[model samples]
Target: MSRRPQLTGRAAVLAVVVCAIAMSLAYPVREFIAQRRQIAELQQQQAKELDALRKLRDRGRQLQDPDYTMRQARERLFYCEPNQKCFVVMDRGKAPAARKPGRAPKPKAPWYESLWKSVELADHGVSR
Candidate 1:
């Protein structure tokens, strides 16, 4: 006949407590793993942003140099030497082939132009 070891009340209570602890820890372990993955993703994004910041800083430093500054001014601002004449070619709604160098048109008045009257009114002297 095989004899089974009988568990005491204290041992049964201890086993139940251990099982409860294990069950409670499971969710926290899974949540911790998910949070670690998210942290890695955020760190990767931070690295990319830092790299972009460094590249922009390098570009700013290059712009401070005389050659790069002069080149950028000439291209973007249409700047030339003092003796050289600068011609600005503009094309309106007309044909592009027949466009000539001229000044661009001015901006039109807004719809509420009458509301912005600023004429000097004549002041009449008040007699006491």
Candidate 2:
């Protein structure tokens, strides 16, 4: 009857080699899974971009109509036909007073004068 080979140094070394090869594959397998996840995320982003593009196309088609163009100009740009009086309503609380342009900035006082002012304030027990 034929006899099986005994487990010696060579067989032990072969078993260790097999185990090492399997361990080495772990990183590659993890990287493959990560790449698959990235592909799925990119596909979802592409779908959202395509939907936005469709909406923009629809807006472009709407703007091609003359009535829509005139309405948009009147509402957004305050455009009016010739000989028509236009009244702009302004909120009293938010309106700014008009100031004349070309005014130069005032010059700063000398450093010694500022230091003396601080000293005077300190002597009078002021917090500033």
Candidate 3:
């Protein structure tokens, strides 16, 4: 049978050089891919910012119109003309519990009397 070719010194050296080149290029290739991804992300962010800018510009144009400004003021700030009356109708379901009248209602009885009353109520299993 024909003998297999042995790896000569020059051939081994060439193989090592090829492997070295590949290893050296690996990191740069990875860095190039990473940079491309970052650029894509930045482009997407720029597009979103441009859309928001357009919306704000439209809002600015709307605010320049006196009729729109007056409507917004009337709706948002409950404003009315000199001859007009404005009444606010509150939703009872969303209203806070009615507070006792007066900043600090004077205790109807002295502190000790109130404390004793609370103790009696607790003893009878009653809650205010």
Candidate 4:
């Protein structure tokens, strides 16, 4: 019975070369993938920032218009033009119900009277 060599010298050399090449390429490949992911994330953030900037630009343009400013003021600050009678109509539909007849809450004594009472109690060393 004859058995052939499972691994030849040339085959071993080829295998070692392939492993060396793979090891050399591994770090660069991993870094490339990570950089691509970071680029995609940055692109998404840039798009969002561009959208916010566009909105702010629109708001800025609106602010430059006198009529827009007046409208905003009237809506936000309840402003009225001179000689224009503007009455505010409060919501009266949600008025609170009157309390049923019961003992009213006792009114608090004046601060001076409370202070004098505290002084007297301290002098007498008595608690009520």
- Per-residue CA lDDT of model 1 for 1-128, tens digit only, reads 98866997889999999999999999999999999999999999999999999999999999789998888788789889799887766665667555456966678877566333322122333332
Runs in model 1 lying further than 4 Å from the true structure: 1-18, 92-128
User: Which candidate model has the greater TM-score, 2 or 3?
Assistant: 3
TM-score of 4: 0.73
Task: Residues 1-128, candidate 3: write the lDDT tens digits.
Answer: 98867998899999999999999999999999999999999999999999999999999999999999999899899889899988877775687767787677565788999899999999999998
lDDT of candidate 4 over 1-128, digit per residue (tens) = 89989999999999999999999999999999999999999999999999999999999999999999999888788899999988876776788767768968689999999999989998999876
Candidate 4: stretches off by over 4 Å:
96-128
For all candidates in order, the CA lDDT equals 0.82, 0.92, 0.93, 0.93
Q: Which lDDT value does model 1 have at 15?
A: 99
Best by TM-score: 4
Model 2 has a clash total of 0
In candidate 2, list every pair of residues with a backbone clash: none
Clashes of each: 0, 0, 0, 0
Candidate number with the higher TM-score (1 or 4)? 4
RMSD of each: 10.2, 9.5, 7.3, 5.0
Winner on lDDT (1 vs 2): 2
lDDT of 4 at 63: 97
- Which of the predicted structures, 2 or 4, would earn the higher TM-score when compared with the native? 4
Query: For candidate 1, what is the TM-score?
Result: 0.51
